[model samples]
Target: MNRSEALSIVEPHLTKERFEHTVRVADTALTLAGLYGESQKKVEIASIFHDYAKYRPLDEMERWITTSYLPKDLLSYHHELWHGPVGSLLIDQEHGIKDEEIKSAVYCHTTGKANMSKLDMIVFVADYIEPGRDFPGLNEVRDMAEKDLLKTAWMVSRNTINYLIHKQTSIYPDTFHAYNDLTKQLYGGN
Candidate 1:
């Protein structure tokens, strides 16, 4: 599906606020993609579908996690994280979006993974720093996003890790992997 088509498909499932957030994320992703010389279409599609399943019922999300063969450990964490992987799967299985890059961007947008590409980083950072989002330290990341994609991505990843730790929430392993990978990219690889 194309951009408008994808937006219509997912928009019905989201609340008004979430739909607006998705639009902001898509806009932010397009900006980041332009800065990084990535594909605008891919980033737009990935950002649009990144939260396609955000409002899905928890039981339905659990079903998607179980039947889709997603890691069982996902359920051990907050169910809030389920939409990323499950939405990616649904966007592929149901919406006919087979691009692995788009799918991976949606999959890892929440708790990013190791070895993400430029599109993935753009989508992830865009979602976090989208204008609708206002959190402590976000201005720093947004400023960094303007100048350095890698630094912005790393800041967002580390921010998530630190927030979860402070909340005593179960930390997803992919978050750490993404943090470490981006750390090496920003500093020196070992």
Candidate 2:
């Protein structure tokens, strides 16, 4: 779908603040797509719908996780992480968006998994480094993004893990896998 059509579909599903955040993420993802040689259409659509299921009721998200092909382990983590995987499924079931690149980007946007594709890294890093967000060490991440995609993603994963550890919250295994995978790519193992 085109940008306008995609935005219209997602706007009603998001709060005002989140809609604005989604726009920022799309813009950022577009820039990264251009830099990283990814398909702008895929990146735009995935970024626009990244939060499609963000506001779904907790029970509904749980139902999607339990009934759909989504990983069951997500139920053990915070409800905050459910939206990405559920959004991936809903985009297909509800909107007929069957592109695996787009689906994978949306699915793993929140907690990235191991061996993330370039498109996945674009959406994932774009969401974190979007202008509206204000996290510690984010500027460094934003800076690194222009120079390197994989390293920037590793930084985002590292920062997320640190933040969750500081909050004493559960860390999703995929998140650690994202960090570890990127680490191995950037620094070859002995």
Candidate 3:
């Protein structure tokens, strides 16, 4: 689907604030894609639909899982990370999005997986660096994005892992695996 059509599918599901954030992320992703030589169309589509399941109620998310064919381990992760995969399924089954890159980006946007595609990195970092996000250290990540997309993704993964540890939250193994993989890629396996 085109950008406008993709936006329409997600607009009805997201709150006004989230819709605006998605728009900003799409713009950011496109710019990043241009700089990093990734596919602009994939970046735009993935960014637009990244949070498609964000506003869905917990029960609804759970129900969607019941019908999903995702692995059992993924279903056990109850945090916001689960929304990425769930959103991907919703976009494919409900909205008829068939692009593998777009679906993969959405599926792995939250807790990134090892060896992520360029499109995945774009969407993931775009969401974190979107203008509307004002969390501490975001500016640093923003700068890192401009200077080095892979480095910024690595930093974001590290920060996310640290944050979850600080909160005493259950850490998804995929997140740790992603962080390690990126760290290895960036720091020559330390």
Task: List the candidates ranked by TM-score, beginning with the highest.
Answer: 2, 1, 3
Q: Which residue pairs does candidate 1 place in steric collision?
A: none
Q: For model 2, name the residue pairs that clash.
A: none
In angstroms, the error of model 1 at 90 is 0.2
Q: What is the lDDT of residue 22 in candidate 3?
A: 92
lDDT of 1 by residue, 133-180 (tens): 988999999999999999898999999999999998889899999999
lDDT of 3 by residue, 53-166 (tens): 998888888777777686557667765767898888888888788888899999888898899988989988998898889988889999999989899999889999988999
Q: Give all candidate RMSDs, comma-separated.
A: 1.0, 0.7, 1.4
Q: Each model's C-alpha lDDT? A: 0.93, 0.96, 0.88
**What stretches of model 3 exceed 4 Å from their correct place?**
none
Off by over 4 Å in 1: none
lDDT of 3 at 147: 86
Number of the top candidate by lDDT?
A: 2
| Candidate 2 overall lDDT versus native | 0.96
Number of clashes in every candidate structure? 0, 0, 0
Q: Name the runs in model 2 displaced over 4 angstroms.
A: none
| lDDT of model 3 at position 149 | 87
Higher-scoring candidate on lDDT, 2 or 3: 2
